[model samples]
Target: MTPADPARRRLLLAGACLAAWPLAASAARAPQRVRDSRALMGTRLDVAAQGPDAEALQRAIDAAFARMTALSALMSHYAPASQVSAIGLAAGLQPVEVAPELMQVLHMARDVARRTDGAFDPTVGALGLWHFDAPQSSIPTASEIRRRISSVDWRHLVLDERRQTAYLTERGMRLDLGGIAKLSILQSGLDTLQAHGVGTALVNGGGDVVACSQRGDAPWRVGIRDPRAPQRLLATLEVRSGFVASSGDYERFFVQDGRRWHHVLDPRTGRPTEGVRGITLVADSLEAVNGLGTAGMVLGARAGRELLRRGEGVEALIASADGGLWMTDRLRARLVPVAG
Candidate 1:
């Protein structure tokens, strides 16, 4: 149940937390784009839209934020009152009935864990020994890690479709939806926008963005960070629809003895993963790229690339631990490399 969004390592510039972008110009007859931001799940959530009705678009944005807020309350691992916490609290006891949305995300997490061979597990809730947050950032001892790692299995989490419940078979097991819930919530935000008939809009949270463009409008532009150069952007990605999700060591991390420890843990080892500095994925749907970004981080470069290559339209941008950059063939076409 770690707090999300460190305001670091994200490709897009978020509110008051990322590198600054230049002011934009508006043409005399240009249509107005309404943009608003709110801090949700510890990250800056932004919504930008351009349409005929500015007031209606604003209302749509409000509804989107409201949907995200409600979903996070149900699924946030950090929230003690959340259904996720309740399921963990009932581990080894009995199944806990959960909301439909929580059930859907749980199913999604299980699917990702299955596909990634446990690399993208949501059941790493017990591996919370490392505190990356300041004032108490401490790494766990080997013994502690071993003890916690024993309970970090995604297989033990069972969901009952008929009963609408979630159960962890093992005692002391925990659930941390920090990985996938954000995207689902944000997807819900986009759904809210569409429900309100706002077609062209972008929803950005943390470093992840989901957006669409009108037929006559220019595509939404997002800046992607260069892991090798923290202060610099590697490239800009234009989006018409779909999503851009990223995972990096810089997100929630600390250094000890020159070694960096991050929140993205290897479920098997119950420690921070290695051999990849960051991973960014762009695809047509959340289902296409849900846990793959972090999975690539855990899988490293070659295997990560192979994994991504398997998917039809999943474009990847991987910054390896050695500082080398690798990307999918198709992704190169979507990028405009940033000039120094």
Candidate 2:
């Protein structure tokens, strides 16, 4: 009467342990990370996140990409319904009301143009007559370029901040925010990740990347690609809560008769700048470094270095056409050069 049967006790103990197994597993499961990329706005927007629940992580990543897509629709010049297109259509006719976000971006573009003395003008969209994506890319004729150059002045892009309206004072005047819009979209993706409560994450909009928090104990590593050799890496950077953006002549160009014609144009001449082959900028805030990458190439190595120094926490690395290299001392410390 006092002793229990051994086989029965063993069976009961096994059942109790089985019931507790699921609870133990739930408590012990560590957060898993997910990484994904979506092609949007002619470039890939990449997202990576870590969360205790896999489904939550996936949802956060999707939300981040959705944010990027929505911003692209608002700012893209290709989208017929985009605010940028609306502004272009109203050129010389009247002021077009735009969303506050578009107004902010337009203001930033104008600021960059003034800072670089029109080197990074958004009104260079007047030269949008040249198409690199055509069936056969070709350079514009001198006469055609001259005709359009008359409308390429940034001063013509009048932004009324109080009204949140933009006006292109010339009939053929156009606006393109290809420079800073992408970076701003990347930042928006990061904000989405944070809104979803995803702490450790990375949002890489093609060449521009913003990393938040740390991956485990180490910071995220980003590769700076060689402008001449897209397949090779020029340097690697380790960062936590930092933004890295690059601009390169190789990004969009066609070679003709041993001459390279790229898309990053100089507003004054209606031609691409030939000073630097590529420029990469690292900064604490994405907005702070927005448009500076291309501005660096147009600003040249000397002015480029000076432009970066003016910022609170900004550094740059520039590769010149003459096979020369220039980098800020702070960036040099954080950069690990790739070996030949």
Candidate 3:
């Protein structure tokens, strides 16, 4: 299929959501497969096996979805009643005991923040003042941005590994997992499927996709959407086992006064990233892809590539704000450019 084909994009989305679920009318089908109910994470999850394994596949999919829902409830900062929100409310006053999953994600968040030199900070919760998704959007004043920037310090997050307690060193500090949590959950789902005797699986959460297992007759193909032309494809990657995560300025943004304000906040400035239209990362692990995607968006183009290069098992493709495209040697080798 052509990468830019609308049907291809839709199919990709369907495959990502349903993972192993067989398409209703597709000519291909495995011996045993069943589609499961959608999960609270808003992604479709299904399983397909080659033998008389319907019951086993169903159980595996159900267990994976349940774990994902529980993790979402615990780590969601938007849900004021979640553990993350509770910790934000109690910031600086007392330590809050977090779930093991939450602690693990937080630790990874902190490490990425340090590696990116605070570019991919979890403390971007301070920028809660702006909502680009709103109908009427306004840019925060310089003074307001400065005030919020002061609260964006990843070091303030103190974790007691033994007790699984996390304390925010300052009041008003919060953790926004919108950056990586969903992809992390997808990775975990893939791992679960692998353990269930499912030799191959694909997990696609919106723009992020993770695929594993021996290749079929043809290598698995992933399309890279064009930010300037959503209906068109920019490139495709032939991947067998790894993760692909993308962050795009086009997905969530508001145009005001001839400028676009997107959801990707620069912790140092408390403003949307500029000069970067989108970033996509290919990595062996979800942690690397998710972390680097965020860092790449914040670092823009040049520095973002450097950041990805420093991390092992990671490669990146960057789309500049001006519509120029660049990829590291590692990524270029796997990329199949699509005609505009």
Candidate 4:
């Protein structure tokens, strides 16, 4: 035998002992494919899983979806009775006690805001002056924007670690977790799946994606949509175990006088961010990827590259406003270009 074979084999065996089960044994048990889909977090949630028992996997999927639904109730921006809504309703009056899960999200949102230096601020909710939705598509007068924009500041959101509460310092301040919460909610669903003994799975909410383990002989395949082309994919990724989060200016925007007014607004200006049009971040953990895409869009391609370099395991594909495409070296090597 080779000198390192025994040690390598021992290490692999140890890994199996620590894990839930060995991948080979899982496949040996004759795993079946299970999939389900539904609307979640204001987008479609598509989940596919693999396990030995179809019935067990299906039940696990349902539980996972249920967990996502529960988490969504905590973060929804439009839900009047949501916990976040309560925080906004009590702004300047009192700190609202929130669930631990919500507290975790708030902590994450604030952390991202701090790290990005307001490039992707959740407080941009205060600039809720533009409506990209049909029948209500409109923008506010410059005077109105200037007034509300003053209240848009992430530092204004206070999280009380001792009391597990959230408070907004300004009377009309709002907290929109749209940039950060969907991935967490999807992650909650994936956690539920693993807790239920299903390990090989993929869950995608609109564009944010997370997948684990292996599917037969190959890893999970995900298509990265082109920001410039709605019908074409720029590339496809083969993920082993990772989180994917994407942000785009084209998703909800209106063109006026040759200017694109998108929902992803810059907190500093109360207007859509300029320079980068879209960003897709892939990382080993949700924490590494969440909010990064939006931050990259605001920071532009160069600064965004600097931001990605700060993270240990993050890779990205950035489509700039000037129609130039940039991809991290690691991703570029593995990224398969879609044939035209």
In model 1, residue pairs whose N, Cα or C atoms come closer than 3 Å (at least 3 residues apart or on different chains), thus clashing, are: none
- Backbone clashes, candidate 2: 0
- TM-score per candidate, chains pooled: 0.91, 0.87, 0.85, 0.89
User: Compared with the true structure, what per-residue lDDT tens digits does model 3 show for residues 1-340?
Assistant: 2345353333334321222222223235433544454635534443232223778777777776667677788888878888889889989899999888888888889888888888888888877888765675668888888887788899998999988899889987888878878788777777777777665556666577777654342334777776656556777777667887878887667888787888888887788888778887888876677777778888888888778778787787788888788878978887777775
Taking every candidate in turn, the Cα RMSD to the unseen true structure, in Å, is: 6.3, 11.7, 4.5, 7.9
Best by lDDT: 1
Q: Which tens-of-lDDT digit does each residue in 89-189 have in candidate 4?
A: 89899999999999999999999999999888887777777897777879899999999998888999999999999999989998889999988988888
Model 2 vs. true fold: TM? 0.87
> Which has the higher TM-score value, candidate number 1 or candidate number 2?
1
Candidate 4 CA-lDDT value: 0.79
Give the CA lDDT, 0 to 100, for residue 142 in model 3. 88
Q: lDDT for each of the candidates?
A: 0.82, 0.76, 0.72, 0.79
Model 2 lDDT tens row, 1-340: 1135341121101100100000112324454757686788676666767667779989988888887888899999989999899999999999999988788889889898887777788887788877765466878888999998998888888989888899999899888889888888888888999999877777776578777773442356677777656666677777677788888887667888998888788777887888788888888886678888878877777788788788778888788888888888998898777688
Candidates, ranked, lDDT: 1, 4, 2, 3
